[model samples]
Target: MKYKTFALSALALAASSAALAQSSTGSVTLYGVADANVQVLDGASSLTRVQSGGLNGSRFGLRGTEDLGSGLRAFFVLESGINLDNGSNGQNSFWGRQAYVGLATPYGKVSLGRQYGSLYNLSSDFSQFSNNSFGASTAVIGGFGGYEPVRGGDGSAATNGGPTRINNSIKFESQNYSGFSAGALWGAGEVAGDTKGNRVADIYGRYTQGGFDAMLSYVDDKANTVGLKTRTVSGAASYSFGPYKVNGGVISVNDRSIANADGEGYWLGGSYALGQHTFKTQYVESKNKGGLVDGKTQAFGVGYQYDLSKRTALYSSLTQFKNDGNGYVARAASSLPANLTSASDRDVTEFVAGIRHSF
Candidate 1:
């Protein structure tokens, strides 16, 4: 969305509100997902625990819109992330998931405030696991030490995309023209004296036709640290036929924080749905091409789901992770204890069973 600001006089505002009260239309909706799971981890250490967000994050949100005439609408969203396991803020801030206000025009949408990056939003269309944190999720395989660039120590820039959200940003999204749409976002650095430090820019294009969907994304982030920058390029696609679906994607990264550091990640997966039962499997890999970051990992995952109703389901997944290099230390699961570590050449096995409901 494109961001625009306007100033209104008190008399004008009062007159508009009075007119809106008489003729304007608007609506508000409350929605959320409640998802949790029991997990077992087997590697250098064994542990069992309950976790939040197996298939989806646990959260609640409010969204509303007002008709502003002329095919234009004003809208706002306030979404908060939750940790069901402990009842704590999932993102450490209220409305951490999304908080934005924007205007929707005939041509496109423009929004301002904290929002998601285009790449992050596009991944859902092509992710077999719906971009969740379980199974063979891309989130697990692509951990080249913070592939998702967040605000640095100086704290000037918003985080860049790895399917992660960005703060202090403005976004513009084009209306779908036939089967294609495009979007771009820019986050100002707001540095004290520097114009370029801690800034992020992202852009993406997508297409959908019949049962096929494809997308490409690019991101550039100037970290708060001096002389460091990160860039990412990604492409993904998915197709569906009958009750079956297939998905695959690749991401390449060049992070200058570590000299010569370059890496790539890829995944291919498919799913079949029949009646109330669905089955899926995926293989994912990440490799480092340069620098001392020997981040190489491979994983295979399989899962099953049984829908109990339109808004609830029972699901389970089994995955195995192989760390191929000394510098690659990610494990097989998400939200694990801080001390959990995977040694090079060691395999980490994970099992998860969960339930998810949405409103």
Candidate 2:
């Protein structure tokens, strides 16, 4: 990825401003994405409006790295999600998107703070749509709810869709050895009396060689107070040949404490790139069991993108969803229109066109 960088120091050169001066060898880069779109939803409720993060989430971030000598480095990232539609905080918190600092060594990297889990990383990397929240996002596909931008503070097992961002956590990621790497993370429950009151543990492994990429991740969330536990496992793979790419993944989640909470979801998709234009399509479905939630949801989506330049692009997508029994999956979960409801299972069709620019 290309980013605009501002050099504040050049070989020990000092600046008049103390904040901008760095005595060590390092660099800080500022980057962000601005994406917005017009969307139309047709279903139990029909509506049209402008939304943010059509192709990608809108956010600004500052990332820096400092060389600590002898194959060691210190790095940090602080990202803030932005809602382009109304200029508000996208993830509620000023730095809800990501906020972490770590030290990188030859063997591996250790970090602490809020960050994404392995499941989210794998989903975004393997999905043709990049798992965006809008359009053909895989967010509504799984029994786990896909990827959630906001995470529970108590490590609640109810959000079992797979942890997107976690707070008060420590993570270790091994450096790539040959074509493989692995990582593990643990989030402290922070409950005074019980250590496992609201704890989270996750692990993942990945391999990348030539045109093939594969990943697997597992997450365990425990809510001791509520006697609820969630376990999730997922795997995904992608292969690229020429200008064509194929990808697929499956996710399974089980929560014995809650009825209708155990479900499985899977998706398959492919894409073709021709010069500056790309076309893609995918099918995703989920099956749930128990009680009124004993239902199934399926969707088909197609999309097109035209890159006008390295930093800007035009894109559009459409997805049609079908609900059987009481399944209530839709295009976007958090940003759903107020008029839309899950009163009864119904079909939904979403159309969106947008522009994205990165800086």
Candidate 3:
């Protein structure tokens, strides 16, 4: 799939709707995903708990589209992230995840608002875990601490492939041509006294044919505090044969906030589906190179998923992360509380079982 504005693409909008309304002039859709899991953490602290958003973040959303004649359409989306375990807003905003409107034309589409970064759109399809906070893309490419540039003292408030979403942004996507598509976006920081002090920008392209899929992405973030800038370049690909599928990608980061904040990582994973069951496995490696930051990390995971129906599944996985240097803190990729210790050389391990449903 091509990376495009979520609100501008009818298919992207429909992916989150729980229901659909068909009309001559327009259509409306309501959609969401509910996923939760039982987790066991065994590191510095050992505990078990029930957590939300195992395979996907629980969410509810409404999307609408109206034809405007002459091969044009007006579309909008309002998506809310939710916490099923506590019945609270996932990110403290009613429309914390997405709220955007755009126009679609025969040539391409343009949109503005809060939306996903094009890099994620391109790399996610090639990830074994679909960039879930689980064993694949998110934990590897977009994880926590200094690997990601810190903003407002929060390590998670940074971007590797553009922070998953951008606020106050404008996006454009070209129509697919012979299975190839390209996209770009510019996110204005809206800083009070500084015009370009805090800004975010990215460009991405994708190609698909037969059983092969590939993508390349580039993003620059100057959205953090003064003098902090980070640039990321990433690419991924996937192929399928019979019931087996394989995927992998590499991500490089140049953190200009401080000398030697540069880092890089890569992952390889595969899965085989048989009947209603699928088996999956993956390996990820990260390095803090140059500058002052220095460390190496490795992660491995294995999982199984059993389909109970078209919209629901039972899944379980075991994952572990090992750190080799004092400053390389990330040890695992799981939403479950079970995780690694910040102490250098301490490894984190976890086991999880979950259910996911979508409508």
Predicted structure with the largest lDDT when compared to the true one: 1
Clashing pairs in 2: 144-161
Candidate scoring better on TM-score of 1 and 3: 1
lDDT of 2 at 133: 60
RMSD of each: 7.5, 7.2, 9.8
TM-score leader:
1
Off by over 4 Å in 1: 1-24, 142-163, 225-228, 335-345
lDDT for predicted candidate 1 compared with the true structure? 0.76
Ranking by lDDT: 1, 2, 3
What's the true lDDT of residue 96 in model 2? 73
- Residue-wise C-alpha lDDT for candidate 3, range 79-105, written one tens digit per residue: 998878788886556787778899999
| lDDT, model 1, position 106 | 99
What range of 10 consecutive residues in model 1 has the weakest lDDT sum? 148-157
Model 2: per-residue Cα lDDT over 184-286, one tens digit each: 9987777888766577799999999999999999888775554556687889999999999999998887765554367677889999999999999888776
Q: lDDT: which is higher, 1 or 2?
A: 1
Please provide, for model 1 over 143-239, each residue's C-alpha lDDT reduced to its tens digit, 9 standing for 90 to 100. 3114322212121122332235777779999999999999998876667786457777889999999999999988887755444576878899999
